[model samples]
Target: MISIRLNGTEEQFPDGSTLAEVVQHITSATQGIAVAVDAQVIRRTEWASTALRPGAQVDVLTAVQGG
Candidate 1:
């Protein structure tokens, strides 16, 4: 397992995990949220290809619907 700090919290996951797998651990309501790894915003199209490393910091942000 690889250890990572996600949004200020420490967590662990299997090695060679992708951004998509991280998203799955988030709340169901965050399905449409955006993710940034180590300060770089990850495009939606790249989620499947983005591989996270140990000690990486992942920030998951959600879009707020407002007028």
Candidate 2:
């Protein structure tokens, strides 16, 4: 298993996990948020191809709706 930091919290997943997998781990409330890894914004199409490494830092940002 590999250890990764998600939005300042430590989490673990099996080795070779992809960014898509990370999205699945988050809650529905945060599912639509943007994801950044190691300071790089990740495109949705690349999520499945982006392999995560141990000690990686993932930041999830959500869009707020207001009128």
Candidate 3:
């Protein structure tokens, strides 16, 4: 298993996991969300090709509606 920091919390997953897997594991709704790895923004189209490394810092932000 590999360790990664997700939204400021340490989490573990099997090796060779992609960004898409993590995103799916975190939430079911994929819309209105942004993902970053090691402080770099990852485009939605590249999520499936992006792989996570041990100790990687992942940040996921969701859009909110406000006036």
Best by TM-score: 3
Q: Model 1: per-residue lDDT, tens digit, 14-53?
A: 9999987887786555467888899999997798898999
lDDT of 2 at 8: 89
By summed lDDT, which 10 consecutive residues of candidate 2 come out lowest? 24-33
List where candidate 1 sits over 4 angstroms from the true fold: 29-31, 64-67
Pairs in steric clash, model 1: none
**How do the residues 1-67 of candidate 2 rate in per-residue lDDT, one tens digit apiece?**
9999988899999999998888778745545678899999998788899999899999878878878
Q: Compute each candidate's TM-score over C-alphas.
A: 0.83, 0.84, 0.92
Better of 1 and 2 by TM-score: 2
User: Number of backbone collisions per candidate, in order?
Assistant: 0, 0, 0
Candidate 3 off by > 4 Å: 65-67
User: Regarding lDDT, does 1 or 3 come out ahead?
Assistant: 3
Tens-place lDDT per residue, model 3, 1-67, is 9999999999999999999999998988778999999999999999999999999999989978878
Q: Pick the candidate with the highest lDDT.
A: 3
Model 2 ranges with Cα > 4 A deviation: 29-31, 65-67
